[model samples]
Each structure stands twice: as C-alpha cells, then as structure tokens.
Target chain A: MHEMALCEGIIGIVEEEARKRAFAKVNVVCLEIGALSHVAPEALKFCFEAVAARTIARGARLEIVETPGTAWCMDCSRSVEIRQRYEPCPSCGGYHLQVTGGEEMRVRELEVD
Target chain B: MSSERIIQVERDILGKNDRLAADNRARFRADGVLVFNLVSSPGAGKTSLLVRAVAELKDSFPIGVIEGDQQTSNDAERIRATGVAAIQVNTGKGCHLDAAMVGEAYDRLPWLNGGLLFIENVGNLVCPAAFDLGEACKIVVFSTTEGEDKPLKYPDMFAASSLMLINKIDLAPVLDFDLDRTIEYARRVNPGIEVLTVSARTGEGFSAFYAWIRKRWAKLKQAERTAQG
Candidate 1:
C-alpha cells in the first residue's frame, strides 16, 4: 500500500535525473531490495507500472536485485547471514544479533536513452 | 532510432522521505524537543496509553501529540481532553504517516523549546516500519492478548523499534500471556530493544514507563545543551 509513495519517490528521482542528464525516456529501473526491509518486490513492480504510466519511466522494466539479510552477533563477535529477524544467529545460535544490512530499498541503476 | 543506456542512478526509493525526516530531526534538535514515534496494530491501546501518559506527564513537561488515522479526529480529541495540545493527521487512504505528513503536523503543533512530542502513527505494522518520521526513537505497543508470535509475524516492525511496551498487562492473569516468552521473542527480533509491561487501565508499571521517558527526555536535553556549548 505504501509502495505507491516509494514509487512516486522513484519517479521523482528519475524525472529529476532525466531533466539533468537530458534523457528522453527510461528503459529499465534496477532496484536493490533488502530482505529485512519487508518491501514486496512484486507489489513495488505493480506500483511502478501504475505510477509511471505517464512519466518518463512509462513501461520501463523494473529489475529487482534482492540483497540478503546480514546481522552482527554480539555473543560471537562476528557477522552472520540472517533469514529473518527472529532467527537466532546461525554461527553462535544467539539472539543478541544486530542487523547490519539487507534493509535497502534503493534504485541502483536506470536504463535510459 | 533510439539507443538505451544504463544510468547509474543509485538512489533510495525512500530518499525523499528520509531526507525530510533528517530535516525534521534537525528542527527538533534546534528546538530541543524529544520526539517519539509510536506504532501498533489497531486496537492495541496506543491512544489509551498516550492519553494516560500525557495526562500524567503534561504538568512535569510540556507535551504535544500528533495523532495519525486514516480518517478521524477522535484520537486527537481524546488527547486534547487531557489538556495537551494534539493535532490529528488524516492520512486519507494512506496506511502510514511519512515524514512529509509529520513535517506539516509539526508546523501546526505548539512550539516547545524543550518538551516531549509523541506521534501516534496509524494502526498498521508493515507500512509504518519503512517510513522514518524523524523521531528520536520508535516505540511499538503490543497488547498481551496479541500473542508472542507478533514479533515473528512482523519482524520488520520489531526490528525498527527501540522500545516495545506490552500494554494491557492487567489481563495477564485472565489470558494465557507468557511474559518472559514475549520478551524473549521481542529480543529475538530486536536484540537491543527494551520491553516493559504495563496496563493503562490499572496504571500498573506506568512509573517505570514514565521514568524511562524522563530519562530519555533529559538525555536529549543534555545532548542539546552539550552541543550548544
């Protein structure tokens, strides 16, 4: 539901960059979605198509690059891959883990003219 | 004939909101205000707790509230009844309150040189987790009846929050609510999160909650003072 806001932000950036870089149209918008961010890539895609219908990114392909969740375990003093926030640290099986990555929802690249 | 090129447009989808959030943070800091963003599911006693807290603490510290709902001034009215200034933000169809909305609400709020402001976000777990409203810290309110699996089901919300208040603990005896297990689960999702159990009805555990607020508020003021020096 809030994906509409995110899509609008993306469109705002794309339009700004288009004006600055003199791009007439956009072809693809690559996004990096983090596992911990809880943003549904499919929903974002649907929103992108809908919100960008009349913008420069109209019909642009959305390429989602998923990033894995990473957290630092306090007990083990090491970083480990985490699938979910509630999952114990895979290395030391500890709950005292601080998430360090995989919460990104960014537009990494844009294929444009 | 057209040629396509991949432009390295590395930007966050939430960049605009995040930027506005930073601005809000700067404004709060300049004004020496401690702001908290409160989130919870619908019917989780968010407003009840806020009303109670404001009623108790407004005399000690000037308090303001921004109530977010899809449509309604009811929560704001409740907070107003407590004698604290409250602004109701109608998000319309929006599920969450973003920095822009908070920005507008902040402008409408009573100016406090150094005080506490609570933004009660619209009742939803998922969407609010992604939007930053320039709060000093995010607080999640969970009722005892909601079950311990809430952290697992809404990991993002728990992960984003710094504190979790287990509301309606007065009914702990009637319901099979596992206090220890709920804390453990909350810690599993947010390792550094501080959890406190309280019941707005019984006023139980509110002193601890109030103490926590005073501590944080003082700390924020101290930081501002130090920065000014």
Candidate 2:
C-alpha cells in the first residue's frame, strides 16, 4: 500500500533531521491521516516498525491524528465536515460536494530537540 | 546581540521507491513492452484470468507478469507454472500496490528482451486506481459474484480503469447479476471504455481477449521498432 512508502518517507525526513543533529529518538511525529486517504493507522504502525530497522526511527513513536473527510458543498455554499467520500453535507444534505479537504497524508508537526 | 531560535530542514520519504519506479518505466518503454497494471478486490480472480491468458499467449509472444499481494508468492508461482516469466511483490501489510512497488519488482524481472508485462496490482478497487504505475492500460478485473453495483459503489475505480473484464461469467446463471445493466452502468461512468465478459475457467471468450492483447502488444512493438529504426 501507499502507507508503507508514505510512512517510510516520513521516517526518511525524520532521519535527515537526526543526521543534522536534530532528535534521533523522534520523540513525537504528528500525522494528518484523512478519512478519504484510505490509510489504516494500525497497518502504518506495523510497517513503520518493520521498515524503521537500523534507522533513527527504530524505536521512535508515531502519533497519528486522523482528519475527518470534509467537503465544500456547492449546495450549501460552505465547507462542511463529512465522514466519508459519498457522505452528504452535514448542515445541508447535498451531493454536490467538491472535496476541499481530507484525502491528506502529511506530517503535521515534529517534536525534536 | 540577538536571541533567536530557528529550525529548517527538507526531506522526502519516497525517494528510493519513486526513483526505482521511474527507471523501471523507462526501461519498459525502451524495451517495447506495454505494461498493464490490473487491480481489484481480493478473490477477484486476478490470477486465474492471468493464468489462462498466459497459457494462450506464451508461445506466440514474450509475456511477463508482476504479482502483488500482502503475503505469499502463490500468485507468482501459479503464473510461472504457465511457462511465462513471473515475479512476486509481497507488500507485507500494504492494502494497495504503488508505482514504487512495481518499480522494485521490475528490477527482478528479465525485461531486457522486448515483451509485454502484466502487473497484477494488490486486490484493491480503490488505492491502486489513485496511483499510476506508468502502464499503458489499467485493467480492472471483477467477477459477477462481487455484484454489478461495484461500479456505482467504487466510482473512482470504474473511472480509472481503461478496460473492465467482468470475469466468472460462467456463474452468471447461478447469480442475480444483470450483465447488460452492469456494462451500461460502467459505460455511463466511463464512456467509450472497453468491457469484456469472460469466464477464465470455462475457456469462454478467451479468444477475444487474446486478440485484444495481441492488438495492443503489436501496436506497442510496432511503435517501438519504428522509433528505433
């Protein structure tokens, strides 16, 4: 899955930081896992541990913060929170949802010394 | 004197895989092989159809297959039994196969000879559709047992696939599948898309698929040879 590579990528960033004498232990890595992104946190955690071998992130902790799948409802003329891709606007039930957010997989922040 | 604190760094995680994928795609194009990345849900019979197709085409043309799965080299082993070159890519816990995965598998393939390669993407109707592995076609293989509403439920997959092969047609009489309506719905989602109904077990419609693949492979090879000359 893309999650393995994605998490690996995040670990790469973390490694680069550690190379520059940042924080090798990682301490904390925050991730914004959008609902529509189709990434399973548990699976990511598993792959992270396996791929992190011999790297700076071998024992580093992963803090994943899930982001709700949201959309911009053309009918409501507003951005509303959604639970899934096919979900209608929360405030006004409509199908014309232009997904403005969600489907995001990014490292929101990092705690390093 | 100033008291200041700053942290700046840039990094990419997919560096290795992405680079491998690009090189694989370049080699594929250079070798005159048109790759097809096939994706669908598990038990969608990606292997069965591939086995049948391989059996039918192994003699006339050179063909290769890249099998992707969460674990086991079962699919790759099966394809190899058909007398064609095959490679297995175990994703471990991955729910989908990315271009990077395909690229890594390419390294293990004997792609020096001009041939056709089929990448059986990890059985997933969603994520695989989101990532392009530089294949000439993305074939979505599904079965009648999985229900015809798959296209409606998985719009992105239906939209992403250039061809839809509704397999297990031999079981249509036993199921409640409306073959025509299913094709109609798929066409509505992807106009001008090619849809083929085949039962890999019954040997029905194999000839047509063989012809389709031949046309594509021939076109790619012709283009490659001409471009070289």
Candidate 3:
C-alpha cells in the first residue's frame, strides 16, 4: 500500500545521486529495512520496479538487507532481539522495552554505470 | 561493454523528507507556531475534533488547519466555517502526506504569525506512521469502536505517536469496547505515549485535550522568546 510511496522516495534519491555522481544507469540498489519498521520487502520490490520504470533505475535489481529488530529490556537491563513491536522482551518476558535498532529504512548502496 | 561502478550512497530513503521536515520545523519555530500532525484511519473524527478545538480555542489563539485527503475540500470548508484559515491538499492516489507536500501547503497558508496549526493527515495508519510532517509531535486518534486490538495490529502507528486520543468515548458504555484494555494495548506498543479520551461529538474531554495543546503552545512561545533574547 504505502510501499509505492516509499518506492517513489527511493527513486527520488536515486535520481538525485545520479545527477550528483554522474551515473547514467543504476544496476542494483541495496536497501536496509528494519523488521520493526513495518515495511514489507516483497511489496517494496514490486513497487520499486513499477515506480522505477522509465527512469535511471529502470530494470534495476533490488537488494534488500533485512535488519533484525532489537530492543532494550527495562526489567532485565539487557539488549534483546525482538521479532515484532508488540512482542515482549525475549529474555525477560516483559512488555517494558525501549527499541534500540531495527527501525531503519535506508538505501545502503547503489551499483551504477 | 559498459563497466559497472559501485556508488556508496548509504542514504536514508526518507532523507529528503527528513530534510524538508527540518526546514518546516525551523519555519514553525521561528514563527512560534505549535504544529501537531493528526493521523489515524478514515472516520477517526480528526476533522470533528479539529472543528471543535478551533471553535473553543480560536478566541484565545489564532488557529489554522491544513487538511489532507485523497479528494475533497470539504474538511477545509468545515474548518473555515469556524472563521479560521484552512487549506486542503488532495493527495489523489497517495495514501499518506509527506513533508514536501506539507511544506508546499505551509507556504501557501496565510497567517505566519504565532498560533497553532493542525495538519490533518490522510486517513491511513500504516503509511502516515512512516512519514514525518515536520510537526512538533504526532497525535494518533482511534475510536473506541475500532476495537482494542488495533494497537496490536498496527504497532508502528502506536509506537510513533507521542499522544493517542481515544475518540468516541461516549459510545464506550454502549459498545462492548473495553476502554482499559484499549489503553493497555496501546501501552504495550508505546510505553511512553500519553492517552486522553475525548468525545468530539459531546465535548466530554476537550478540556484535557485543550490543556495538552496549550502546554505545548506555551512551550513553543517561550522558546520563541528565548531565541529572541
């Protein structure tokens, strides 16, 4: 749903970089998406192709680097890996947690000509 | 044959939006306008609450509204009926409002002097949660009829919001909705999120909501003064 909008944003970045770095065509785009970020990888890929059409990134392959959701448990005072936002701390079974990582959505790298 | 090159972009996908959001934030701070982005699913009473709040607070402080929807300037019309400036930005096919769109709308809006501006985002929880609209904070509203499991289903929206307004509280007693459980579920996702129950139709909890807004507005005004001194 919103993946299309996100893909549009990605294309914007790609085009901006192309203009700055003097690249004509983009071959691969590696993206870092966190589990807790709520972005669907498959949907993002699908939308990326559709949005990237007729652009510098046309026919580009999307390389998604899925990052694990990490949180700091308040009760146990330790960093824990979480699968979902509503999930309790894996180590302490407590809901009191502060999310530390795995919420990032960024374009990590690009292969271009 | 063309040779390939690896460019270390390493940029946030939303970097452009974040930059524009910072610009919007600076403009707002310079003007001392307390801006709040109201987001939720459709029919969550965002416009209703705004209409009521504008009516109540317009006398004390100048109020403005930026309404976002896929189509229709009706919400803007409704807000303007309260004698305040309201601009409508139709997203067409876009599900959420981005910072660039908000910045454009802000530029067109009149009355840049000190006041409060409410940017009502298009009705969708998932997409809006990802896009920051350069507001001081986000306020997510959910009706009691939407069920308590909403937070569990849409954790990102709950996690991103600074305040959660449980709207339609007057219908809570009639429905099978468990208000306590709803608040508990919201806290499960967002431990620090402030919750307030408000019935925009009945004006039951407007006082508390207004108080929260006033507190933030005062803080922004104070910052404006300190920056000047």
Candidate number achieving the greatest DockQ relative to the actual structure? 1
Candidate 2 wrong stretches, greater than 4 Å: A1-5, A20-36, A40-104, A108-111, B1-16, B70-73, B90-108, B124-134, B152-159, B180-193, B218-229
The lDDT for every candidate, in the order shown, is 0.92, 0.76, 0.91
Q: Which regions of candidate 1 deviate over 4 angstroms?
A: none
lDDT of 3 by residue, B64-146 (tens): 89999999999999999999899999999889898989989988888758888999999998999988888999999999889
Clashing pairs in 2: A1-B94, A9-B13, B40-B124
Query: Would candidate 3 be rated incorrect, acceptable, medium or high by CAPRI criteria?
Result: medium
Chain B TM-score, all predictions listed: 0.98, 0.88, 0.96
Model 2: per-residue Cα lDDT over B144-174, one tens digit each: 9997778777766776688899899999998
The root-mean-square deviation over C-alpha atoms between each candidate and the true structure, in angstroms, is: 1.1, 5.5, 1.4
Residues B54-138 of candidate 1 have per-residue lDDT tens digits of: 9999889878999999997999999999999999999999999999999999999989679999999999999999999999999
Best by lDDT: 1
TM-score-better candidate, 2 vs 3: 3
- For A3-30, candidate 1 gives per-residue lDDT tens digits of 8988998999999999889999888899
Model 2 alpha-carbon miss at residue B36, Å: 1.6
- Predicted candidate 2 versus true structure: per-residue lDDT over A10-29, tens digit per residue: 88777766677655465566
TM-scores for candidates 1 onward, in order: 0.98, 0.70, 0.96
